[model samples]
Target: MSHLSNHDLPRLKKNLAGRQEHNSLKRYIERTREREYIAAKLSTHSPIEVDTSYRVAVRKTLINPRDGLSMKRIIGESDLLPVSYMQAGMKASKSVCRIEIRDSVGRVLGHGTGFLIAPCLLLTNHHILECEEAAQFSLAQFSYEVDLNLMPLQIKSFRFVPEHLFITDAKLDFTVVALENDSAEGTTLSEFGFLPLYPESGKALLGESISIIQHPSGAPKVVAVREKKIIDVYDDFINYTSGILPGASGSPVFNDEWVTIALHHTGVPDPDDSSKYIVNEGVRISSIMKYLNRLKPTLLEEQQVLLDSIFAGSELANYDRNPMVIGNLDMEWYERSAGYDAIFLGENYAVPLPTLRPDLRRDVAKLTNGKTVLDYTHFSIVMSKSRRLAYYTAVNIDGGHLVSVPRARKWYYDSRLNRKYQCGPELYNNNDIDRGHLVRRRDPVWGSLAKKANEDTFHFTNCSPQHKNFNQMIWLDLENYILSNTETYNLKVTVFTGPVFREDDVLYRGVKIPAEFWKIAIMVKRDGNLSVTAYLQTQKNLIRDLDFAFGSYKTYQVAVSNIEILTGLDFGDLRNYDPFRTITAVTGDIEPAIVNVINIPSDIRI
Candidate 1:
């Protein structure tokens, strides 16, 4: 055999590296072990056997010892209860212990039955921890079964692992609780024997038999195993024939060899036929092992605090007190997306109203007169118009209702004059650029007298100066963003944009005015509240004069006051107009707290 050179050796190593599935294989082995453990534990309990001959004889003879014996036998020989029965028995025996959870209060918020996995370790769901107040769990008030009813089980302590110390993949829905000590006195299964866990192999064969033992509805632990086959594999769910029920979640499913193949989580029920049960679903054990490996280091660090709390027997409470919005409107609102639109493409056209021109041009003034603009981007047509103020009645009629605007047209001066008199002869020249209305012309309601009245609304006279890039890029982004917000918050927005005017000879602060400047202003309203935002762009980098060029101090004040008068809502304090700050506050409210818990520094892989 020829020895390979260094160059060839590197290539060979890279090829081999790509084929390594060691981690996946290792997780498979761990799951198999858990399954085996459960199967072994269940096999130890014998199922009750029925005496068919005695039953037949009893039916024929009314008063015979055989008949009596048959009845007694039937009553005594019940279905076999497996190892799961013992666990369920433990839960039922202690059900009344009142698993108290407090959101920094003594009042009970949420309650559930808990079991001692280890001396100090307790188990519960992840959602139970959400609250504004500090939470604690306790078992001190719980009672064990004595006679027919439950009696108090002395709990030494209650401690919960910090949210960050553990990893929970919704895919698995199984949370592991690491205990401080392994010494808790309870009914020992050691006498009957424990279930064996499955070995770490790929998984059970597609048609292999399986069984599950769990405490259903917190009832007595029952060993209900079914012979079923693996039907399908989903991203995070495994479909099998094993039967599962509520309170059975987090139970282990074992193969014939007693290795754990998966953790039972839920079952799908047939809606058409209630009697027909569907496949049971579970989180693959291999996935669980992957997360466990990731979480192990963090768990080790917090092992002491967790154990101490369990020893103290603290009460656990849930505090999800946020108001749930319940109504038709609440259902309509949704999170904003990048591609939301305001109107359906096939809808009838409606004219938009003109508003105040930022350029102070009288020709374009009518577009700003508090009329509605149709948003065309979203599927539903959103009309953005303010309620009109009634002058004589003193009562505001039709004040805040959405209204349609009529479209119109006008003309602009050609660009020839600019070339003929270039420099000092003419201060300004009207170019041939079409006076395009940003609000649009064909959008207004048709067949009404207002139809012709809106014709001028489409003219360039009602337009603003906008560069191709600025209009198509930044302006488009802004319009799309606002429309998305309308769908998300169910609000309406009116926009006004146009070019700024400049004089050829006019000089302010030793600088000549540039003709290619543009400005945009937006007004939004929802639920009687109104807000206005504005921006400006120019051919020259206008960052230095952005504040003044968009609108002077006096211009902004007048525009805002005018908008307030037209919309009938206070703009609030200008100091509170920080868009970034408002967005940050809203973002904080919606983000899940679990992210913070899981991102703790200690949980970071080294």
Candidate 2:
């Protein structure tokens, strides 16, 4: 087939014939005038002059004598003087403006800078407003230099990007502020002047040249054009060889065409090496633009609402003012009852508190082996400072004596073998499961008047029903682990133990029985480290009714491993109790029995 058909050629020729000729003379005049304007502006002094002290400091700190002499020599020898041209360009673009923060005092805090964005929106780091309790900011008129002399410049107002609407990806270290009220007074843009946004998809390639315009260290606007290679692009930030300095954060970076592609943010300055220059890093503009486009609608709506409210007198007139009240509860309350005090102090203290007493408190404490009351119930009452809060069982002289057996049914039920065994006894089977104690109630010290004063610790609110085998094996192991570690770790071990009530009315032989099987949950703390372990009995009877309770064993094991890694303490030995027994009871129920012997070393520190 022919590349160009006869019909296509005629159409192409007809289209070419309709093309209009350009006015070469007018175009040439326009191009010449643009060049003249750029050159004249470059030759002129900056509209905002640099402070003399800053100039002197820069010369003393940044300018190397050898390099300065060499640059002078190079300027004399070379036909191209780009540095001089850049200096001239910097001077022409500089414009001084005043920044003011409206505070609760109804007065303004003033700062100076060479600001370029119009309608006079001040660009600043987000952290600047972090401490301010105000809702708005304002700007005032300042001065600009013209013809080498300072002239008054009017500033209508200031606008800030919405704090809530803006999105920031710290990985990129970039933020975008969309202009809201562009109608601010004295705001103007040159016909050819506009901040450029990055094109989507492609990035500035390696070895690309870039320029930055910023008010470094609150100095006048300085345009630094440098040719630098892109060294790295991380998830959220880009690193380049372009020079940047302190106080340049939020400054714009543009390409040779004056198109802004990035916002200057941070740099590493090397004071040890005089010849070393700071490397600049910035947030890519394309990322910023994407976020801004998403936020534009919301920001516009919010700004309109704010404006309407301001004009309609609906806005809070003294919204910028700070409140004047702060107080704390009396320490006496905490000293009297640590448990009650902790609940109040933790969070949302204003809300009504839940009563420490639960229904289980009355039932479980009444079912104890002996007629004596549990210690934590008394502790709870003492902490609450309320006699009504304490629950006690009627003293029964006929109740069985508190038997402290070395190996209990709880130990066998808590064993790994019992947990692995799927077939188990029924939960309420009298012959299979046995009730076990975590904090043994009959132990002399635990039952003593002083120890029992902290009733909250002994209350049945902390107990759970578990299988006899699981409690004896796994539960005993956990308790032993805490006791073993406490010798040198100074750990405080608080345990809550009880049996699950199968029925409120199950009769054992002739007597009414509460439940079978026991459970134990222990909270241990040493120095500042805290850990919690829970054990459920896996007796043949109990497992049949509640297999799901031990389903979290895998997760618990993982947590235990993590604790071991962090604390460098071994708790695995605690799980080494014999599992063949039916009922293993804790033996020694005296004051200085197993409890007192397991005292943690007081010298252990965090």
Model 2 lDDT tens row, 1-606: 224332443343233212200121222233455434533542452211211343222222221232334223221232233354454344324422333444444454333232333221233333222222322343322332223454433333444444523333433443222233332653432211223233242234333345676656544445576555444343334456745655555566654334445666555333456344345566665565455444434543333222211111101111101111122223232243322121121132111211223433333222123322322221221111111112211111101111111111111221111122111223233332232333333221222232322222222222222333342322333443333333322222333333323333243323223222222222223332334342323243334433323322110211222222222223342222212112222421111211111112111111
What TM-score does structure 1 among the candidates reach? 0.28
- lDDT tens digits, residues 516-549, model 1? 3222223333432234343333343321242223
RMSD of each: 29.6, 31.0
**Residue 480, candidate 1: alpha-carbon lDDT:** 32
**What 10-residue stretch in candidate 1 is worst by lDDT?**
388-397
Residue ranges of candidate 2 with Cα displaced over 4 Å? 1-103, 106-124, 128-135, 138-194, 199-203, 227-230, 269-278, 294-606
Q: Cα miss at 282, model 1 (Å)? A: 1.1
